[model samples]
Target chain A: MSSINSSGEPAAVRVVGGWASPFVNRVVVALKLKGVVHEMLQETVGKKSELLLRSNPVHKKIPVLLHHGKPIAESLIIVEYIDEVWASNGAPAILPRDPHGRAVERFWAQYIDDKIPPGIRVLRGSVAQDKDKAAGEMSTALQHLEEAFVECSQGKQYFGGDNIGYLDIALGSFLGWIKAVEKIAGVELLNEAKVPNLAAWADRFCAHPAVVDVVPDADRLVEFTVQHAALLRAVNVPK
Target chain B: MSSINSSGEPAAVRVVGGWASPFVNRVVVALKLKGVVHEMLQETVGKKSELLLRSNPVHKKIPVLLHHGKPIAESLIIVEYIDEVWASNGAPAILPRDPHGRAVERFWAQYIDDKIPPGIRVLRGSVAQDKDKAAGEMSTALQHLEEAFVECSQGKQYFGGDNIGYLDIALGSFLGWIKAVEKIAGVELLNEAKVPNLAAWADRFCAHPAVVDVVPDADRLVEFTVQHAALLRAVNVPK
Candidate 1:
């Protein structure tokens, strides 16, 4: 943790996050890369802790990184804040120096944030006849995602080439949920046959030391999904 | 106007944008500020122009600024790109230079971006008996917003203080839309009696030379809303 100042103030980054949240994982990976130390508080979402409630009064969502009492909500925003505050030496810059490169990265990150949620909607919609429609939408979204990776990466190992960047973090959060949806729906969105580059990128990302250490256990995630998938499906089914 | 590059190419930053989009207006303001010369192309949303479709196939959204043949999409991302590329000597930096100041600015900007749309939901839920319910939600949102602005500006004239930064530009594009909604909805969200600082801030932002020059014409916007409000109302009406 070279980022810590000599005064031993702990560099003051406390993440109010949940255990199963992939969004929280993105922030965790970023903090780890920055060599910053902080307490990680696992929040109960439906019954938000009083501290979480006070820290993020507006959204009341998890992954709120409270730095010295001021909370920064939204996982991506917190990641950027970590990068700015820690000023890591020789660590991967989450954004590119080239203006164009930065835009491309942010563009994909925003797209994933906005559009990929529809796939989650569809995944939740599975098990009803309406599930079929949601499944179709998910398929289309995955196809578009495949095309995006093919175009953006060209031949690079990551969105930023050789090393993962913001887009990688943004997109990587989906892998666990996506895999769970694939199992629940009996379909595969990230078939290597269709999106080899994205699949490879996912592999490289999962292998990264920072990512490997922080990601929630895959077997536990799968078991949890298997338990909860039924209720989620029932709720999303049109009455 | 001081940002003419050494290439002597009509300062040739190219913009792929659409009319009638607030996101595109963000880029337009930044370019006008730096006096950067740019070639503009209007690209459609559902059916993009060949150039845009090819250049920004990943997101397939407009407001992609091309500099030296590279494309940058998403509005905020483009704003940052423009700021980085065209920032002249002694001109106000769109983003704050101090890490803490930057973090605070970004926090509110993200807050506004995430939460303000729901505040405008009053415009949507007007016809139903639950219209009052929607208005209540709007009021709560506004109250939160009042606190946010107080915290954001404190004694400063702008989020960046005295100088219009990214937060101002980001919020400015929406002020016209908010005013338009207020008129049709017959409710004032930013009444001076309630949100005096924010109301004054909005007034100052609209009067800023860069903002005044680049914002869409009020009359045209009013006319556009008159024709479109009916369609919006129909979309939001309860079944």
Candidate 2:
């Protein structure tokens, strides 16, 4: 840990993240859950900051955590790093203490990362042909996630049992996006009839005080989607 | 850990892997490095086994480590699980003991996973248009990896300082494929002048006892690539 700055704040803790990115939101939720005091630096998409590029030269992506002048990239990796560094800081454990349990959590978190992007593309696609094809792919991805929730949750409020854990934070950050996508695509992704447990889980996750404070405003995110509709269409041209 | 079978062997330690898969090879190298007595269950690429599907229902992917009848999927995650479970079995540490060092190792291992597949696609592309585009993408990816070696290795014999570690196992498993791809594409990917450190790193990695024992024979891998050339070309068609 680095010493406090002249302003009497933790000098080492800083995060470069985008306003509407689920990946960035994951990191923000983790930091708040861990009770770490940090400054958030906003980086816009299509125009990344020099700091972000320098910090993450390989990917030049956001959600890079700068701790004591060192940068760590990738959202899940950053969350895991936060968990390990702040393990003794009196916060709830993000990952289970046991090795096997931790492995299970990691498996699901990776699963979410693997599956969600296709769904996002489907929602953002302006062409009917692309949207239909992506819808089928996204459906299969969501079905797998639903099965995972049933198996891993075991009827608990969160994947970490009583408290929200790694997979919860990983997937929970997407609730607002899921809503925005549903509106844009005119389709339901997590309907109560189709994925009841996951629907409840999303509601509970979004309602958490720590998460609520950090997540982007839903109406603004929806508005952001509409504002960027043409850009999304151009990026998601039928393939 | 589970009890031994009637033969007094660790009956539960088994890996479902494919001979030609770099992902599968990563798991094999880790098992051998940790000195874990495990059985290797071979799987064909297109014709996946029922056992593999049953073990890993979510992904249905190979390199699933079956420990005590429990299945763990995804190569990197499985390697981490093996490291943690066998930590006390007198094997070399796969990840650095310090949290920050471990994070750095994880980041690069992930970088390799994210970047190498696209390079492989470029090498396998049959169409000139696709190949030309893929070549530029592959070059950029390789350059980033070259820089990574310079930054992380620091003139050491391995990324793990004096010995092999997580990133070493993760990237080293692709050695045979790299050789085969270079031959197939008629291009140099890791030449001494281009990426000297990584070139030396690859040579050291391939010569290591653990890696040598598990990596598929170089000649056989080249033959495999030749046999599957059409399939590879079809899959790599500009997507």
Best by TM-score: 2
Give lDDT tens digits, candidate 1, residues B1-239.
Answer: 33445776633578877555667778888777766667777653335588887877765666778887777777788888888876665567888776666666666666666655555545634344454565566556556666766776667888667777887877777776567656656677778897777788888888888777666654655666566556545543111
Listing every candidate in turn, what is its Cα RMSD in Å to the true structure after a full C-alpha superposition? Answer: 5.0, 3.7
What are the runs in model 1 whose C-alpha is more than 4 Å off? A1-11, A124-129, A150-154, A226-239, B1-11, B42-55, B58-61, B115-139, B227-239
In CAPRI terms, model 2 is classed as medium
Among these predictions, the greatest DockQ belongs to 2
How would you class the docking of model 1? medium
Error of 1 at B201 (Å): 1.1
The per-prediction tally of clashing pairs is 2, 0
Candidate 1 versus the native: TM-score? 0.84
Q: In candidate 1, which residue pairs clash? A: B1-B34, B1-B35
Encode model 2's per-residue lDDT on A103-215: one tens digit a residue.
88898888877767657756765444577666667667777777777776788889777888898998888778777777778877888898888888888888898898677
